[model samples]
Target: MEPLNIQANQLILLRLPSQNIKVVKVEPGSIISLGKFGSFRADDIIGDPFGFTYEIDSGMKLSLVDNTIEFDEDDQMGAEQAMTGHKITATGMQQLTSEEIEALKSQGVSGAEIIAKVMEGHAAFEHKTEYSKEKYLKRKKQKFLQQFTPYAIGSTELIDIYLDKDPTRIYNLSPETLALALNMGNIRPGGNYLVVDETPGVLVAAILERIGGEGTITLVHENEHPNLDCLKYLVLSEEERERMIKTINWLELFHPEESEPVRTKTAEELEDLKPSHRRQYYRAKQREENHKEILKRADTCGFDALMVMTLLDLPTLIPQLLRFVGGSRPIVLYSEFKEVLVETTLALQKENRVLAPTIMETRVRKYQTLPGRIHPLMTSRGYGGYLLSALRVHPNRAVNAVGKIS
Candidate 1:
């Protein structure tokens, strides 16, 4: 087969077909050995001046346009090999399977690496099963996995980085994106914002990382719950965790009031105490100092917050949440799906405390193929996620008489 070239921002996904388990992501510039069958690096097949194609293990070329390779011999051999570990007779290119493709997309694997791996060894063989004859056509009909195709954003760019995390992964929004959102309307550096369905402290960490103002961020969850339970298993390095870890969980902050007045030096008399008495006075003050840190966790609730309520409950909860911040602040709501968001939005629109409420949706696709004609393709995964944004305006509030809209 013709030697392949690989490029950046792409990946290869491998799987255990029987178990539907994603085995690994093919790293760029690394050699993957299918054993005596052959070995190749994902980078070997990307960015070639020529388009994608396959050739025999002897280096005899075949173009996708020619389409002359027979699947019959290859298919039979692939089945035999899958069962008996027989080596492939020749090198040929094909696409990754649907499950493998989707797994790569979820991890934000790029397209370049995908194509190279396909050239290296796309199994053109049929998976053997008791229902093989009946399921054969059905399985063959599945071409590229549809969901793995990348979703379009507002515009295309020459280069973009993709990060794939698990659905429940703690996510910190990009500072640039947040900065743009904050500057959208009357949002300011220290103003409080509300989050729904966010991982514990992720959004807060993003905010704190950006505009390091003294203003506090309040966290809200249903049943007076803080979201720290979700953080117990995050796969972050210790260095990253140190900065991300803040005791935002409301349960961790609750303190009893009876512990107060642990100091007994009488206020007036305490002020006049000599340095020696003051030293002894502060010695007793250690307990109060410790308790202060504990109570501040809850009582010092930085930004006012509310619960995760149903669509019906939003009408009541949104207004109450607005009252806490009043009209001067901004409210951010994130929904996992759009229908509920539309319902929530309609309710908020009627309240008249909302100004410039917006619905924004973002999508990302990874592992794009650049140079191949019949590309070693994997469709991108995360297709239709959304974001809804709006400004909260109070009834009878003064209008900003003049400003250019973005």
Candidate 2:
């Protein structure tokens, strides 16, 4: 059998007994070890272009360094250092049975000792972030307790719970993390992009950080009254804020017959207009200005492309959305579950105008266990969602199997 190959920008998912996680490995094996559960050779992990799963038939030998047991060493020294932070190293991973892990837990063993035993097998473990020894101890305790069981929730349930919480327990991505995802999406500088997202400030903040050149962004919402209160946290320069174009009540603009047309006086016809007619024209012009102001906060314009990241029912929104994105563009949709996204994928396929739309999922896994443990490793967390991408084809072209309108 051939060894698995890993690729850049690829979404990787690893499911462990404790939890599932998703992550995009931007760099090859940069200190990604499971701490004590087990470790892998990062150099060996990077060269696999195709992903594979395997178990070591026998235990592998790891290089070890001796530590001098000295008296008067500050207990806080190592704990304080952990406060800075540490990365996972792909070395020193040992596979133990679950029975071994259970025994340690039953003995009231400390998590620090467990993590240390797992880490001692690797030499690449380094501290790069600021960490305090005390905080590190607390964190390790949490990690030990968190490994007890896995928590699973549906997408809707998660959204409902998170939205209601003042200080949510959910770990959401920041602008930097979102930037990483955007790069995975192949977003480029100086390109017009369309965005439909509920988190206005967060979405825009991420875009500003990654977008370069003179590219334009069009933000869309359900109505002229955009719920952009969350955006207040995104501090933007006066000049940069002015560059954004907005549109409000997206449904009204895209839905036909929602806008009423008013007659305008051409130069040839103006000569024949009476004073009374001229008065009506001026009044209509005033109304237009008033309407524009009411929607100003939510209205953006001059979009060279389209993207939908907002919260709307896909079944109802897709038809209306199709009208906005004529052929020759790309539509990328993100979902937390395969079920919610499968409908959209099928809808695009029925349209028969989409190109080879790709559907994929991603996850990140961490292997960690204590010395003399039975379980080889445990999973850390689930960190990815589903992705469906399709290109809008123009009228005069062939559509692919996944629905690409050429």
Candidate 3:
């Protein structure tokens, strides 16, 4: 395996002190501006290892630093002092005016120096309670810190980026739901999967990452072209992209014999064509071969697993999709609402083509993990979506005393 580094034109996640994330394209020789947090040359971060937090100096030079403050078990007293629920008056806390702060920013002072200046100018610094002081310091640090952490783009982080920036782009799919789909589908290296993704490639990207270019994904899409827009953010090489994923229209999957007949040209006919016409003819021939392969795969109906994250009606969709999945293979379906999965589960039970259909939901609650002040955050996501999973099976025939179709 190769050491992960920030590569040019790759999408990297820059997490600021305020915990806000920005997805930036690393273009060498370009300057990436982070508003008041200051700007740095893209070359400064390129070739650096991912997952390192760097602080920008007064001269705009980058230095590796540990941005997170670790709270040890021995710091219980300090933690208690920091969250004592004491309120302090905001007035007279600092004497620096907005103009003076702006001047300090313009002077290119380091974040630490600027913070120290503000702290020194605060008139009521000694008057505030310890908890209030700590809170103020934290808020100010987040506001004035000229630091950013670059994280390697993976499925989880990619989902987080979209969740923070535009949830609609990934169809509001949560990380927990995404992970459940992969696990319940039993994705593995060298396996063949049938996927129906309306998340526009987030699900597919996750699968690709899990399989690590060793599996095949036949994506069934309703549109003329597969909407794999989210794949643009992933750092897949050309060979991996070409070898791991194949797209087929839903109509084509349902009607495999509808593809056009392949056209073959004799040597005489090829010799008579112009150069451009000959190129066009070869391109068409290659496409025809690819199309035949896709149709052949669809006709086989023996995918190792089936994973779906689409808005299509599941009760109708799952049964139809299961026909292509091999016996005893897993089928995992994801939806934002439980009612949708509940209906689909009931339908699957009636079809008897699946075994032990189950509807599952998972929710993750994040806490503020200070030593002695641990508690659930004031705000958190309400839901993480639902998963409906079952194994494809071939039902045995019923008879009075011998096997027969019932």
Q: Write the per-residue lDDT of candidate 1 for residues 1-406, one digit (tens) a residue.
A: 1113323433322221121212122456665543322344445444543333332131222222232221122233444344553333325555667677657645544333333344345354333432442244224322222111111111010011122334333222332333444444233355443434345444444443333443334444444444544222222244443322323332322324433465567878888999898877885575355435434542344233221312234544565555544443455554445666677788787667667667666553333221111222244434343345665544643433343233
Error of 2 at 226 (Å): 2.0
Q: Candidate 1: misplaced stretches above 4 Å?
A: 1-198, 212-215, 221-225, 229-313, 326-328, 372-378, 382-384, 397-406
| Model 3 clashing residue pairs (backbone) | none
**What is the TM-score (0 to 1) of candidate 2?**
0.45
- RMSD in angstroms, candidate 3? 4.6
Top model number, TM-score: 3
What is the C-alpha local distance difference test score of candidate 2?
0.45
Cand. 3 Cα-lDDT? 0.78
- For lDDT, candidate 1 versus 2, the one ahead is 2
lDDT, candidate 2, 164-270, per-residue tens: 34212222322223433465444566755666766534454445445642554556667655554433333344556545434345654554246675667687776
In terms of TM-score, which candidate is stronger, 1 or 2?
A: 2
> Model 3 off-target regions past 4 Å?
1-3, 70-138, 267-301, 399-406
What CA root-mean-square deviation does each model show from the true structure?
15.0, 17.7, 4.6
Q: Pick the winner on TM-score between candidates 2 and 3.
A: 3
Arranged by lDDT with the best first, the candidates are 3, 2, 1
| Local distance difference test, each candidate | 0.39, 0.45, 0.78
